[model samples]
Target: MNSFAKVITTLIGSFTLLIWVGKLDPAPYPLTYPSNFGNRISIPQNNPTTQAGVYLGRNLFYEPLLSANNKISCGSCHEQKRAFTDGKVFSSGVDGTLTSRNSMALVNLLWARRFFWDGRATGLEAQAAFPLSDPHEMGQALTVSAAKLRQSPKYPILFQKAFGDTAITVNRITMAISQFERTLISADSPYDRYLKNTYKPSPIELEGMRLFNTMPQPRKKIRGADCAHCHGGAKTYLELFHNNGLDEISTDKGIAAITGMDSDHGRFKIPTLRNIALTAPYMHDGRFNSLQQVLDHYSEHLKQKHLSPFLKGSSNKIGGTSLQLSAHEKKAVIAFLNMLTDTTFIHNPEFSNPNHP
Candidate 1:
C-alpha cells in the first residue's frame, strides 16, 4: 500500500477510537455506599460496565425473543412486585412445566459467595444463561437465541451500541444482563433511617430491636433471644445456608444437591432481610406464611441440631425453654422486621423493565 493510503487509514482509526471512548463515559447518580449485603455500585475492572450496556441489557431482560417460542422473558418469573420473586411456590417454566423450588428474591446479591439454592452457578453472568436456555425456563439454546437476536432489526442496533459491533454473542448477552441486575440494590428502609439516627423507631419497634440483637440464653427470664447470630450486622444480612429444620426430613436437600456432601443436606442460602415485608412465604420452600410464623418456627421449635451452633432455642425469654412470649413479644419481633421494608426500591423507575416504557 502507498504511504498516503496508510496515513489516511491510521488517522480514521484513531478518530474512531476517540469517539468510542467519549460515547462510553457513564452517567451520574447519587452517592451509593457498599451495603451489608456486600455489592458495589461501580462496575468491575475487566468488564468496565457502561450505561449503554445496562440499558440494552434491561431491554433484553424483558424481551420475549430470548425464548424459542418468544413467549416468556426473565421478567415473567422475577417480577418487580413480590420483591422480584414469583409468589408462586414454584415458578412455571416456558412450556408450563413447573420449577423444583420457589423463586428466590433478587436482593443484595453482590455480597453473596454463591447463587441459587443448589449453588450451581458461581457468577451472575453465568446465572443469566441458566434460565435463558433451561428447557423449562426460556427454552432456547445459546445458538438459537443468537439467531433470534441477530435476525431482529432492533436487537442488532442495540447490540452494536452496547458492544463494539452488531454481532451478538452469549458472553455479551450474559454480561450486559448481569450489569443491569447488579444495579438492583435496596437500602432506603425505615431501619436504615433509624440506624442513621435521622428518625427514631416506635416504642414497640425499639423493644423488638432490643430482643432481636441480644445473645441466645437458656436459663434467664426477661431476656432477649439470640436472633442476631444470623440476621444481624451492619448490613443486617447474612449469606447463610441453613437447614432450618424446614421439614422433619427435607425432601429438598439444598446445597447437598450442588455438592454431593451429606452434611450439606437441606441447607439453603440465608437471605437478606432487607425489604423482608415485601418478600413473603419465607424460607427455601415458601412454606411459612408470615414473619410471625417464622419467628414461631425458630422459637417454639425444640431442637437446634443442624442450626448454626451459635443459635440455641430462646430458653431465657418465656418458658425457660423457648421464646414463649405472651403473643406480645412475638408481635413485637414482627414489627421490627417491618422496619426493613424499602418501598422506594420496589417502585423505583430505574429498576423497572425498560421495555415497559
Candidate 2:
C-alpha cells in the first residue's frame, strides 16, 4: 500500500477508538446534601458515584431477578413511603421466611461506615451482599445472580454504560447499589427547616426540641429527656454502637456476635432519627411499636445490667434510673420526634422505582 493510504487507515482507527471511549464514559453524578451534614461522605475511591451507575443501581435495587424466586427485591423490604423501612416487626423474605431483625431505614447512608443493627458489614458495598445471600432473605447465590444479570438483555448495556464494559460481577453490582444508596440523603425535615429558620415550630414543638437537647442532671435537679447523647447533631445519631439498656440479659448477643467480646454484648448500631417518626417498631428486635412506647422504655423501663454508659448518667444510683418524665413531657418529646419526618424525601421521584409511574 502507498504511504498516503496507510495514513488514512490510521486516522479511521483513531476515530473509531474515540467513539468507543465516548460511548463508555459515564457522566459524574452530583450529590447534594445539607451544608450542616458536614463535608465528609463515606464514598470509596474505587466506586465513585456516577449518573449511569446510580441509574443502573436504582433499577437493580428494584429488580426482583436478584432473588431465587424472582419476586423479592431490596425495595420490597425497604419501601420509599416508609422511609425505606417496611413497617413490619420482622421483614418477610423469599418464601415467607422472617428476617432475624427488623429492616433498617436506608437514609443518609453516605455518612455511615457500618451497616445493619449489629454492624456485621463494614461498608455499604459489603453490606449489599448480606441480604442477597442470606437464606432467610433474598436467598440467591452471588454467582447465580451475576449470571442472571449477564443473560438479561438490559443489564449488560447498563453495566457497559456504568463501568466501561458489559461484564457483570458481584463487586460491580454491589458498587452500583452502594452508589445509589449514598444518594438517599434526607435533610429537609421540619427540624431541619427549623434549624435553617425557614419553618416556625409550634410552642409545644419548640419546647420538645429544647427538652430533647437538654441532658439530665438528676443530682443538680436539672430535668431533661437526655436524648441528645445518642441521637444528636444534624444527622440525629452518632456513628457508634450502644447497648441502650434494651435488655438486662441480652439473649440475642447483638454486636458481641460480631466482635466476640463480652463488653460488646447487647450493643447495637445507633440508627439515625432523621425519619424516626416513620420508622415504627423501633430497636433491633422491633420491640416498641410506637414512639410513645420507646420513650416509656427510656423513661421507666431501662434495664440496668447491660445499659450503655451514656444512658447510665453521672449518678451511681443503679445506673438505669428512670428519667421520671411527666405525661406532658413524654408528649412533648414525641412531638419533637415527629418533626424529624421529611415528607419531601419519602415522595422524591429520584428514589422511586424506575419501573413504576
Best by lDDT: 2
In angstroms, the error of model 1 at 300 is: 1.5
Off-target runs (Cα >4 Å) in candidate 1 are 1-31, 34-44, 220-222, 302-305, 312-314, 317-326
Give the C-alpha miss distance for residue 98 in model 1, angstroms: 1.4
Q: Please report, as a residue range, the 10-residue window in candidate 1 with the lowest summed lDDT.
A: 22-31
How accurate locally, in lDDT, is each candidate? 0.74, 0.88
Local accuracy of candidate 1 as per-residue lDDT tens digits, 19-67: 7753534542232644443443335454545677777778888889998
How much does candidate 1 score in TM-score?
0.85
| RMSD over all Cα atoms, model 2 | 5.4
Please give the lDDT score at residue 217 for candidate 1: 53
For model 1, state the Cα shift of residue 228 in Å.
2.5
Residue pairs in steric clash, candidate 2? none
Q: How much is 4 displaced in model 1, in angstroms?
A: 33
